[model samples]
Target chain A: MDKKGNPQIDLSQSVDFLVFWGLKTDVKAFCNQNRREKTVQLCNLSRTEKTMIRVNNLIKNYKKVEALAGVDIHVKPGEIFAYLGPNGAGKTTTIRILTGLTQASSGSCCINGFNIEKEVRQAKQQYGLVPQAINLDQELTVQENLIIHGWLYRMKSSEISSRIDALLDYVELLEKKKSQVKTLSGGMKRRLMVARALLHGPKVLFLDEPTVGLDPAIRRKIWALIKKIQTGGTTIFLTTHYIEEAEFLADRVAFLDQGRVVALDSPERLMESLGAWAIDRLVEDGMETVYFKTRNDAERFNTLKSEQYTLRRVNLEDAFLDLTGKKVK
Target chain B: MIHGIIAIYFREMLILRRRLTRQIPSWSISPFLYLTAFSYAVGHGVEIEGHTYMEFLIPGLIAMSSMTQAFAIASEINIARFYWHIFEEFQASPISKVSYVGGEVLAGMTRAMLSILVIMALGFLFGVRLNYGLAFFIALLLNSFVFASLAVALAMVVKSHADQSMLNSFIITPMAFLGGTFFPIDRLPSWAGAFLNLLPLTHASKAIRAACLNQPVSIFSYVLLFAIGVLFFSVAVRCVEKAKD
Candidate 1:
């Protein structure tokens, strides 16, 4: 009633949807849902607040160059958000800040409703971190690795065993439990990292270049595995220079350039936003991508094409190149 | 912390078992060579400290070899970590700093103890008379533990494996020589012999040799050495965790 003859809403009144619904919901059902979410969230990093990981005016200097200039990002929960940038774009630096490995010179971050600086232990508990480095213990057996993970979270021995059995079954490593990690294949080790992250049933996971060194076939396997995990309910925060990777796995993609978030949106939304751009797609030895947005635009490009290639719609890679204005560095 | 240490200890021990067969010949054979050169060659003419020159040298060589091997294990493992990127996997785990340092120290201790055992076995073959008893085992274990902790601490401080090898010519080499590992401490200048007591290994070797030659126990020296070792153990863990950070 303050103006324009309309009812004035109280700006101070805010609803706690999570707590309200959580209490009203059946505890057993809620627990089961949480259990289901644990797998999905094992690779995700999100916050209860609107922003999952908030990095404010962050600065990180590595010798002569500043890795991260002042950066700001807003991510919501349950999104397969890919953080993309060229080499040295601070994508990993931003990720490191979110995950709490490298401390920010002057900034703050939060994860799953807790401040990352003040409540780091709690923040860590909420998200599993798969670092760029291979983090599995080589001497420990597969089962031993999982047990050690559970111990990190201080999980009860009985609880850890049950979860280990279930996780080993899920990861297709039930029989490899007794085998030492050093003897496992690279793909197997990658899968073990996933299993280790899931031991404590976290709500989010931070996957930092998950498939960096794998072959295409193994990459696809890992991708499919990530997809399978996501569909079960965990949100993911991924950082990679691979355009096609972001395209294939991410729900929403954010392009980071020069320590700034250049672009952020769903793959479809991004393609639609860049309305006038046309992509000429011809793989190195095959017809991989040949797509256009406008017929007039396609006509201009037709002068350069031959009949040996197929033409289709432009993809995430095109949107990425257009938005970031740089390819993988 | 204890759990992580034990986990690392047993895990390393498991790997050690795989490498032990090769290690035995490598470490044990050198002592026999030393025994013939010092025990038989020198012993035919010289006698000092109420025993043959060979007897005095045996205990010292045992201590020197064990200390050198202990430090080398620490340095080698860390250097190997950098080359293999094994530390990255360690960093990725949720294991605390205590466990990480514990693993290195435990591995070094294992090697040192193995060397002591090898030295003990070689004592008989080389005609070095050393009595075997429960006291000897305790002395050996404690001596190795002190050397291992010091070795790990040194390893954590050294920037590179190459640097560590260089330090053996300066830091560790002098320490071994001055630590009374190669000669009777009493035979040195009185002030220098007292200075030798400052090293944990010196007291360890003394306690070990005292038990060996049926000499009277030096309780003050034993407690002081254990105290020094405990201090280094704490400090070693600190240095390792700091480097990791």
Candidate 2:
């Protein structure tokens, strides 16, 4: 119970109602103050918007193997939450469940106040997914991909046309709109994917390894686009094995290992909790890492090391390795 | 739900339009060769069931073309599943299983219809003509529906394109030749005719030939075809549900 005579709500169970009411209130206030005509009300944006993505005790069993063993997650509205794990660590499985592409063996999840199991259509309408694979229609033009996605969401033809142009411009692929997706460079295809996912203006955008195969320069470009999308108030749920990706773009990162979350916190907080500096030393088995609270302490440890070593700032990868005793990538 | 079906069908139509140039020649050439070789070389001046052999073969060819074209959807569905992964896109969307299967079945029907038109043109060039009436078209529609639904079901189960081709060789090829498409099944041994009678294409050919030659068309064959189509459609929907999970 609270001061307003409202019962105390467990955030995990009532996240949907909170998001709906908060968003409803926000929408009403924005419409009143600005009186914008073109602004489409994707949801009742003014009532209550809080946690945009919530997963509770989600379990997925594949025959004899348990792919996801009772995973739990909560992403706040407009927050960039990164899910970090290695291959076959249930990252893609979790994304598949959230996007309605696969069923969980147990537990429940909700997206933007809509239960994934009971209210599939409503839940799907709340989020747009950029899959790990380049699943765009390769035979279709860049513009056609976006148009088809918009049509699937049941947007009007005129709205689809205008939104395609705007999204293409946003991703800097306006010049290549007429080109077939197969002809575009890898980076361009990735940009087009980001554009396609945003065409319907979904409240939550799931990016599953959005920059996995791209080079350093292109990965940075995608990171910038991700930040841009976040600034527009769309909650971004990103999954990646790239440790640097989480450190660079995530407002909070969850470290997952063997289908279970080992740690969850902001990248800085995670690293700070370990140490301020990290030293990597070459050993017979593999590289071993040691962390220190200060540069002076790292230097003192360096004096005691006989093998080759490199001193650097502590990163999310170190925090992950320390927690799980395994490499993220 | 309907909008999702429309979206899938519209994309297929676009792809078909783009590949029409390369596709039309192949679609026409096979039937043209069949007409020239089988009708001219074998038929000559023969008659069967009070009609010339060419008249008899034309309707059979229409039935066969419709069946093969409808079943051709299996290959396309395989490509979408394994190579392009378009099925994943549909699974991720708000589209229902019914809409996905319905849209794909309709696309198969469209392809079957186009192939029938091509076969008819070739039949005309070979100096063979028959009454193209509502009943004839209706029989063709039912036949295409049966095979298209079967294709949708088979595609979900087949593991690869090689498996699809194997099915084509073992099932479809044998049915096309032995199901009274090119020759009279009655002329064969009674045992062979009894076995071929179990095939859907055999009923399709018999019903279509009756409609084209203005004979007494059997309503039972139409009912049978409709029943088989509905059954296969339900099976396809079930397969899609399983595959999506």
Candidate 3:
């Protein structure tokens, strides 16, 4: 529909969009009618303003290997949600599912209300993923990375140019704009990965281990950029084994363990459930006492040690160990 | 499908552009040296089927170039996946398996065509004449595309990149050699002639050579090779799709 609400688009052109997205004729017609009704009611709103990514029980197998058993996750419009799991725990497999790179054994998934298998183009239009590996063309310069990525997404020339400039500046790579990817440092390449992923201004950005191998300072820098994007209302789905990365960046974190959602909540809430304290025994001269309490109570317990023996502080590290713990039983 | 093709094309071309400088000296130039050494040094000015050895060698060289690189596309991509950790990147991108096949086919064809052009130019420079004219170029292009499709498909379906290398060495080498590469196939054993007919390269090179040598072209077999190429290409696409699953 045009500005005057005259329903200016021809049915044929709309039909083509539906075909490109792989929607069946009936489903296409249904979506078209729904969109028409919604447009009349909410004419001034942006599309992709609702849920960005949704996955239900996605499973994948490789010969005898079941990489992803069954995974279910949903990401709302504008939050940086971290998908955390140990190595080989299906984090990459889930990202592969959401991105439509591989087929799921059985499941339903979508991005921004567009079913991924049926409407891949529309689903793709919702997000970009910056992989853990550098993945940039070592032969192409930084400029070419943005240009080709933009071209892949079918962005216009002017928009591509503007986005490249803005992205380079955003990632603080403005000076290395013409430099080849091989010439960039580890941190610079990682930053370029983010820039490439954002070329089309996707509503949701998925980062797979965004800071996996980077030094602490570089990791902090990438996390800071993720924060800025999440602030700007771009939903971010990131997978990282780095607990600190998830704890600092994710608004909500799902701790995936052995292909199950062992825990899912805000990092603070998950930590709080661990009670922020530990019980330990202090024995001297063949006598001992054990105590369990919060950090404040632990502080009072610490006073007992200062007056008599020894004391220790309860922090997030201990709390994380308590829940989804890794030590021997 | 078009977007997927475009994305795959970009991805493969970008990767090739980065890797070409390193790959060319080994893959493209080294093979040229082997041809020069074999046809010029060893043949020693002998007439092959009433033509100069070099003239006899050009078509085979062109076909060999296509055959070698076309199949190597799969091995190279698979190797990139495991050795370079690059597969994770493509896996995370929204580029589908179809796009992956599309891009690889485009890139492999481009590389195959580049090799064909280089070999042809060298044959021309060396004064090797087959008198087939522009028909030769068209045949060469078709051969290039067919071999490239087969190669990309081979790369996707094969379990191991190392096995791919073996296919190139064990499978590709003998076929290119015995399929009228250095001399005419008619002078060879009868079993070899029957065997060559079964190979895709034999048809691609035969159509190209027959047209270039100005013999009556086998229009049926030319179309047949093309149809077979399309089938192989589809097989390759299906393999890639299944690989994703």
Best by DockQ: 2
> What clash pairs does model 3 have?
B8-B103, B74-B155, B132-B212
- After aligning candidate 2 to the native by TM-score, how far in Å is the CA of A44 from where it should be? 15
Residue pair clashes in candidate 1: A1-A8, A40-A234, A41-A234, A43-A205, A44-A204, A44-A205, A44-A235, A281-A289, A290-A312
Native contacts present in each candidate (fraction):
0.09, 0.62, 0.29
Q: How many steric overlaps does candidate 3 have?
A: 3
Candidate 3 structure quality by residue, lDDT tens digits, B130-189 = 665776766666776677778877766667767787777777878877766666677768
- For every prediction, compared with the true complex, DockQ reads 0.07, 0.28, 0.23
Candidate 2 on A208-327: residue-level lDDT in tens? Answer: 999988999999999999999999999999999998899999999998888898889999999999899989999999898889999999999899877899999999988988888888
Q: Tens digits of per-residue lDDT for model 1 on A9-122?
A: 643232223332333335545654564354224324434345555555677776567788776666666677899888888887877677666666555566766555555567
Encode model 3's per-residue lDDT on A1-329: one tens digit a residue. Answer: 88887777577667755654454488666875674454323212223445566666667777668887777777778988888777877887788777877766566677777666666677787889887666776767899877877767778889989989998999999999989888999999998988888888898898989888789998899889999888888899999878778878988887776666666788788766655555455456543333355667766776666434433444334444455564211
Q: List candidate 3 stretches off by more than 4 Å.
A: A1-49, A59-70, A276-296, A303-320, A327-329, B1-7, B10-45, B85-99
Question: Per TM-score, what order, best first?
Answer: 2, 3, 1
Give the TM-score (vs. native) of candidate 1: 0.78
Most accurate candidate by lDDT: 2
- Scanning candidate 2 chain A in windows of ten residues, the lowest lDDT window is A38-47
